[model samples]
Target chain A: MNGLNGIGVKVVHVGGNGNAHAVLREIEARLQLLVEKGEEGSIDLSGLPLMPEDYDLLEETLGEGEVVAEVHSLGPTRIHETGIPGVWWVTHYNSDDEVLAEFIEVAWCPEILLTPEDDVKDGLEALRARLFELNPKSPLGGAPSLDL
Target chain B: MRDETLLDTLKRRGISRRGFLKFCATTASMLALPPAMAAEVAAALGKVRRPAVIWLSFQECTGCTESLTRAHSPSIESLIFDAISLDYHHTLQAASGHAAEEAREHSMKQDWGNYLLLVDGSIPLKDDGVYSTIAGISNLQMLKDAAAGAAAIVSVGTCAAYGGLPHANPNPTGAVSVSEIIKDKPIINVPGCPPIPAVLTGVLAHYLTFGAIPDLDDLGRPKAFFGESIHDRCYRRPFYDQGKFAKTFDDEGARNGWCLFELGCKGPTTHNACATTKWNGGTSWPVQSGHGCLGCSEPDFWDGGSFYKALSTPISPVTGAAAAAVAIGAAAGVAIGLANRQTKAAAKAAHQKATIADLEK
Candidate 1:
């Protein structure tokens, strides 16, 4: 027997505390703002007191959309567009795969999806170095000019 | 780590701008700051150099240290702890004997009036404070010595914040809290049996982000964490409103996860972040695990009364108009009390400002 010693386990079902509806209302307002003014907004879901059933209700209400993105930085971040257009669900995790934060983002595109200018520059430099390594004889050879 | 700013360290560790922003946003939420303050936190945290911290353990158990260190690595608490330059901690430091004492003295001298001095457990005052000594140095003497040049002091546990168990009835050691002894420095009390890991780290983050202590309650606790009573935020509050309570350990109400107020829950009077922040990485708190709050965060809680005995305040079910009136009355009382405390705090702040201005002049 798996450590239970004959103790019975019971699972209790509890209903939502109406927190999901409140969150959905806030999301609606943020979505409206996103539409009218092209403004981006996010609610920190991790900070709120949402129960498991509340989370289920929210998921069921929002549904899911087409776009799904994963960002690997400090850890993996999952960004999914909800069924509602311009509404996104973002969950950040640490290296140990423990959730660090969760957000309900309302925007055309979440900020985390955009490539930073600095990283883009670094990527360009890396690409140039790779090209030089592939063909050393080429004029694009050593210490390629920053004009590119 | 000592020379580099937090931003530089994060960047060196391959954390991207987006990652850093996410961390900042998480920190803002953890600190209960407005979402708009995330940018401010980011700006401040990026520029903050790791400040030296000297953690001193005194006349009690090391539960506080364990509570802090038990958080899984790479978690927010651990990350914030990592960002600090921990110059001295007898429990965690590698040095021993004279070398350990030497490190403490060295950090104290080097950082002088700027380093953060963290203290867990109370200092014994009886018998020339001979009861508890580290390397032959009495806890009282060491505390006084370290506190002399420290910029601020953080009393880490209930023992160090209040007198705790040692200072309960029939006290032998004549133990006293850090505040009772050291009154000059700004002391932030993170009091619990062992404070929530996030609460301690959140205090540290607030200090690092703003270059000042977070706004504190009347008890010198960070108001962000201790602002609301656990009862007010408890999941079983609806049950309490409906007069459903667990009378015994194996009662049907207990099985149904009803209110534990009848079982002597101190959540009503006890202010803490546990109801919301939970424990063991948001897993469960004492109430969630079918136990009542022990009011461990409050002063003299050990001597307050039996933990199993319900509070003197009468709790009864009231509906409609009566419920609304009760709620309004409680709210008004709380508001008035808070107003009075705020006024007093403001006066104290003004007095300190004037004193500083005088010193400058």
Candidate 2:
């Protein structure tokens, strides 16, 4: 049993069609392209006709890396780097913790991890509002010093 | 009657930009579109208002509705329902009697020529269509009335698409498909005993994203889901190619996961996304569970033949002929080789005699 977004999921292993090697070859090619062109690329793992065994094979071969994260949005999105430096595994799950999409991205960082410009702008305004509410009139012309 | 756009609704529900993006990517993948198209889908879906949808059920077993509702919550498939204002459905609606009929009429009058019409099960035509009736209105009359104002009609199951089980052998009520009755509006046929939930949602997503129906095959099915035969995309195809087959349910081949073609697997001719998209949220489909395909998506599958009988001939007759030709060609090559050897041996003997005579001279 594996827990995703607080939901217990039973993972069942099944047979494959021997396409895991082909997918590995594709990843290698994509990695090479990333190296030569300095361009990012990704493969939609959910779109492929891969079985549980194929997924297991890919996971075993890729192993694990240092970085791992969980982004809570609609539900939860898990993103982790594989053993390879540039390869990342990203999975998006719905509120029920069912996998909505999965991808193998070859890039410095997956796109979903980046904070949107609008979000940053909103965050700045929110922080300013909260600070003003905390100290409407403080020393140094309404700006409180960190030493306080 | 929510006035907010889809994006607004998602935002109100606390879904972030990343979540929406993820939903769009999943939608694109479900529709078999490239990942890049997810942006386009997002742009279109974000601003689009919910379209009014009217679901009409006739001679059906409620299987299609059951199949659709089985889609996991908060999933993209379920989100499609949130994207649409479902005005009327006998099974899912809260209203009934005249009130139920009133909602259907109001939706037609309010969103006439724009509302999407979804029909399941066949419509009986014989005997003045008295076999089935909703709110005292006959199935035939109700279909014609509803179809008149619908922008387009989606025949959800094999029944509404190809006159399914109700129109099987004997076809007591002389039932016919929606296309046989409604001619003006464009109809998308999603034929299956009960279609995959994602397929119906994919069609809806394509329509919602592009404001037009997706590319369809000759049978009016979305080509994205019906383009490839199950056998062609099946994991057991290699077994079929190697002539490995499962003869009985308990046979060694069956236990070893061999091809089910000899066991009346209709995957070779039946086209659907089951082999890839799979059923029960990518868990398993019939073939994966060690059962032969029933060819449920094809037209007239009920009367096609026995489910247990093997296909009369190989999927492609030419394949059998080619195998026979290869064998005959191999035999002919051996015979020609023997003849060539004999000729070479005789020529060598004659050359020896000639050389001896020359030496004597």
Winning candidate number (DockQ): 2
DockQ of each: 0.28, 0.32
Residues B138-239, model 1: lDDT tens digits: 999999999999889999989999988888877799999999999899999999999998888888988877778989999999999999998988877878
Interface RMSD score of each model: 2.1, 2.0
Error of 2 at B31 (Å): 1.6
lDDT of 1 at A123: 91
lDDT of 2 by residue, A14-101 (tens): 3777777887888899899889998888788755678778888999999999999998876788999999889999888877787777
Off by over 4 Å in 1: A1-11, A135-143, A146-148, B72-75, B313-361
lDDT digits (tens) for residues B1-361 of candidate 2: 4555677767766777778878777788888886768889888876666778999999999999999888643456656778788999989999999999999999999988988999999999999999999988999999999999998999999999999999998999999999999889999999999999888988988887777888889999999999999999898898899899999988989888899988898998899999888887777789988899999999988987778778775333478789999999999999999999999998988874357768898
Task: Tell me the spans in candidate 2 whose CA falls farther than 4 Å from its real position.
Answer: A1-15, A138-148, B1-3, B313-361
Model 1 clashing residue pairs (backbone): none
Q: Which consecutive 10 residues in model 2 chain A have the weakest lDDT in total?
A: A139-148
Comparing only chain B with the true structure, the TM-scores of all models are 0.85, 0.85
